[model samples]
Target: MIQRKIPSAEEAEKLKALGLAVINKEAEAVAALAGRINGNFAQACCHMLACEGRIVVTGMGKSGHIGGKIAATLASTGSPAFFVHPGEANHGDLGMITGKDVVLAMSNSGETAELLTILPIIKRLGVPLIALTGNPASNLAREADVHIDISVAHEACPLNLAPTSSTTATLAMGDALAVALLEARGFTELDFARSHPGGSLGRRLLLHISDIMHTGSEVPVVREQAQLRDALIEMTNKGLGMTAVVDARGRLTGIYTDGDLRRTLDREIDIHGCRVRDVMHTGCKTATPDMLAAQALQIMQENKINALLIVDRQQRLTGAINMHDLLRAGVV
Candidate 1:
């Protein structure tokens, strides 16, 4: 093997120019395709919406990589889809194609031998073909039921050999298709959360305060007439750092926390015999069981409180929430 000489600054500048050229060319292609969104695009979206089976995406080489990404985006955004490599299709992957499935085949030149090899078989299976190609007259485009013209004047590569501009155009078109179908299908945030239940959005959208709040006997509560010592015991036993002071009707009257206890102790108040109502803070902050955990976190931060009593419209104690509960629920 022999060593090659490095290019001078002028040569490097020429190479950089080629990269910028590719970006510019692809940008123009995307703009042109966006302008061409008319009846054909609408028809493509309508066909996909009416599809009963998953969309089968197929491509070769760089197109295959983009195809896989497009399939993933479709699957995550309410449309059922998956990628099947053209090369694999010839070797029994063809069984993945069903008559009800819609096929999205990508090819810059519209004549990839591997992809073309299975085109006839896909047609025989009666699967509707949607072609993304640079040449509308190419075999793939001509045979497709709907042709999305992704033709670009030239690639950004100086050698014009690498698939740069064409691949970018294809990816943008894939995004456009996915978003169009997403809107047409009226996909809601809750629907998206269901598909991504393992993510943070799912946690926020699906979690409710009642799902995590301490309820029943675990709730720290004492009557307004209860002694301060009894309230302290309730707080310590519940471990929620706060206790609700309610009336005989179980209606929330006030609240006592460790902070209030410290303030009372500093004043030398008699905890053993003093009523909880005398030492507790009146009109304490509260939340409802139906409130979102995220909203509860906001309330705690705004009021600088560590815990909140869950109450009904009648001010009766229903449950309780703490900062730790919000943290565990990912609301913070």
Candidate 2:
């Protein structure tokens, strides 16, 4: 078997130092982001926001990889966006773009032949082009509607051949553009959640109280004058560990929970004689049907309670939700 040689302490230290130097270079490149946030960046955001169509991102090789990530960020953050390989444009994928769309083209040198081949078609279609390039004087930058210069003083590689700092800078610029557009459009967290419905954020933002609450016969409710024994029975039958106490006119007055039962037992109150209104907790927090389930979870956490009753504007008990419901629905 071939033996592997271990690096000496001096060589190991040199490797670590090199890695740190690379990180510093990338950090400096990202720091330069503030200076690039000028009129050009603002114009890019405005073009994207005013476009009635999708933002089509195109690039080649390493730039393409960064472009794809930028497109994903834009799409998830409320801007409609997608990536198309510049090489595929002449192969019929060009139909994906239209006059209403905004094209974001990325290239460090900005003279990639495949991208240059599609510029005429993009211009003829009246689609605005935004170029992210290291060479501001490059043809791609000159022909575009907006140019985001992502030039770096040097590559992280010692030889300045590999795309290290340049790629990092390009990715940072893409993130900057996405965030700028997100703010310009007043995009909210809820909007981001809607686009990411398969993720946890989607479940928290989209799931509302009405979607996972118990209603009708599933709701554990009892008249305020009902005995503690009756309320306990309703709680048991509904399996929510709690019951809503309403007045004779069907308006919510208070709630009785397992904790309330323990407190009553401590007081030595007779379950058969004590009315629900006498033992139940009044002003128990309630939620509206349209309230986000995550918001309801926050209320439960802040109040240190396990259940929440849902009421209409008229204070009529419409539904009930508990910790278990929020847990099962992934709202917690």
lDDT scores of the candidates, listed in order = 0.90, 0.92
Worst 10 residues of 1 by lDDT: 34-43
lDDT of 1 by residue, 1-332 (tens): 89998999999999888778766888887888876577777777877888999999999999999999999999999999999999999999999999999999999999999989998898898878998898889999999989898877777776778998889889998999999999989999988988988888888777778999999999999998888899999999999999999999999999999999999999999889899999999989998989878778878989999898999999999999999987888867
Error of 1 at 260 (Å): 5.0
Model 2 residue 295 CA deviation (Å) reads 2.7
* Candidate 2: tens digits of C-alpha lDDT, residues 1-332: 99999999999999999999999999998888778889999999899999899999999999999999999999998889999998988899999998899999999999999999999999999988999999999999999999988999899998999998999999999998898888888899888888889888999999999999999999999998788899999989999999999988789999999999999999999999888889899888999999999999999999999989999999999999999999999877
Top model number, TM-score? 2
TM-score per candidate: 0.82, 0.89
Q: How far out, in Å, is residue 47 in model 1?
A: 0.5
